[model samples]
Target: MAEESTKSWADTDSESSSSSSSSSDSEQEEVHYLIDDQTSDDEVFDFSNIEFTREDLVQALNDMVHEYKTLSHTFEEIKAENASLKNSSAKSSSDELEDTDSLKIELSKLRIENELLRSESSELKAEVEKLTK
Candidate 1:
């Protein structure tokens, strides 16, 4: 009879442990489900609080317009400046081309003069040699 009681007590202990584990699992699942529900509700509630008033919208739009105008003015100024720089650069390039042409003409004239001087020097040398002979 004592052995039977001991066996009964052991069976009761195993049953309780298993039941407790199952209960704990179910409690964890419930907690997770509640957390998910709360998170969804909180997100919805947060969105509801983000209302934009008409005045705020108007101010934002006006600010954007002002910024756009300023940017447009800046862009136009840059374009004008760019055009001026291009004109100046073109004029400078034209001047440089003219200078190059003038230098070329001067160099040609100098070469011709150098050749004439060389020819004269050769002729003078020949005449001197003949007189000496």
Candidate 2:
């Protein structure tokens, strides 16, 4: 049975060109077909049932392109703002470091002056003690 089925399939494909020619001749013979229980002599194959037009699709794509452009501009603006803030922060931190360095130098000068005053006071005390004796 399987062999018979295979043989039938093989025979069907053996003369494909002849089969196609016969089918074409039969199509030219003119047969009747039905549609929705009504006979349609003319095959009115319409393609207007689709919703979107070329113009509608083009308009939608243009709108999406405009939105993408606006988003890119906004992203650039945010990035510029972030960069400016970072630069300002770095400048302010450097300024603070300079101020701290100046304060440290002033403190060092004051300490030297304090040591000189202590040495002068000790010399004056020794002179007063010699005068008392």
Give each model's whole-structure lDDT.
0.76, 0.70
Question: How big is the positional error of residue 129 in model 1, measured in Å on the Cα after superposition?
Answer: 1.8
Instruction: Using TM-score, give the best candidate's number.
Output: 1
Per-residue lDDT over 21-98 for candidate 2, one digit per residue giving the tens place of the 0 to 100 score: 778666544432223334345433312326634445455556777999999999999999999999999999999999
lDDT for predicted candidate 1 compared with the true structure: 0.76
Among residues 3 or more apart in sequence or in different chains, the pairs in candidate 2 whose N, CA or C atoms overlap within 3 Å are none
Residue runs of model 2 more than 4 Å from their true location after superposition: 1-49, 125-133
TM-score of 2: 0.53
Model 1 Cα lDDT, one tens digit per residue, 18-87: 7777787887688667656675644422222347443444555567779999999999999999999999
> Please, what is the TM-score per model?
0.60, 0.53
Weakest ten-residue segment in model 2 by summed lDDT: 30-39
Look at candidate 1 and tell me the lDDT of residue 87.
Answer: 100
Highest lDDT: give the candidate number.
Answer: 1
